[model samples]
Target: MLVLVICLIIFMTFVMEVGSIAFKLTGVEPSNARFQALSALTGTGFTTKDADIITKSKTRKKIAMILMVIGHIGLTVIVVFAVNLPQLISSWQLIIGTILCIVTYLFARNRVFVDKLDNQIESQLVKKLHFKKEPIEEVLLINDEYKVAEVRLETECSLINKSLASLHLTSKGILVLAVKGEDRVILTPKGKDIIRKGDTLTVYGKIKNIEEILCK
Candidate 1:
């Protein structure tokens, strides 16, 4: 809906230019007007065949810069690209608009996708378990400074048969805040509760020490 509204605004602005807004706004220089309109619509920085002539006025130059930036970022080049690409088959304005839109969107979307992927990888690591303990195996999860971390309970481990009170994890500065099982996370286990094999323990503590407890 937001994209549609913005694209509509751009289309309307383009249509309105046919009625002399170009000449009224920028005088007799048709090329400058065309450049400004294209910059405003696509957010591109390219100047016309006669850029030297338009650059004489400092005030007009500044205005051009402001409109260019607003057209590119505020109006959103990505949404414009997505909108104009399919419409270009029948209209030349849409064809030029779509080309510019695709270029801008590609640049922006790459950054967005990288950030999202980083977050997803972090989330998965925080919820992962260590099946067989090894120094190299410990490197898979994020460092221990992170408050939320996961550790897998092995069947032969001493804590497996003992009650929650018996292990005394707090003595080592670690806290087992939750136990993640097949279907749910147990935040508070009773004193007599015994950990089972394959249980994913969510621990909170210093990173180095957390690794120690998981490997021990």
Candidate 2:
């Protein structure tokens, strides 16, 4: 549900960008149907070829952003798994390496085993990629689970390029644990530090409430 909502919001943002292109570049009036608006905006060489973004450089650039976002979200699962699998396996390096010859043969010869193992890897990969429920250490130290989680962000919310305080999550029961950005990961953020994009915020709070605020 959380992933679906985030993807849907991203989709809607793309659709709106398409609508803007349709109005400005294609000279076609915007419509209530976002799907149609996207088709029109992309100028996917539909029947209305004149309206297609290929003819308009600016619209084409905007379309590129949509494509890039789509590529990122769609391929994230496969790419993340491929990149992280070695790291996870390396954690058991000594034992695994000792039995590498047998394991390699077993993994390669049986289709069923290979498929099942890949599925397991994919499942674990997605679970790790989900940023909603953080680990215990990443959360604030509170006496009880009932306590509201508050993360005081020194940097901006990387995705939205805004300050931590502007996220307006304290009212929603979320706490900031750490601010991690370029060069360093600060366990506790100071007021003046600027939160930039690509920073991983370690946050804590009631799992459900925190998920609702951050994932949404």
Please, what is the whole-model Cα lDDT of each candidate in the order they appear? 0.52, 0.47
Worst 10 residues of 2 by lDDT: 131-140
Q: Where does candidate 2 stray beyond 4 Å?
A: 1-159
lDDT assessment of candidate 1: 0.52
* Best model number under lDDT: 1
Best by TM-score: 1
Q: How displaced is residue 33 in candidate 2, in Å?
A: 42
lDDT of 1 by residue, 141-208 (tens): 34536455556665565566677778787787777777766666688966677777666676777677
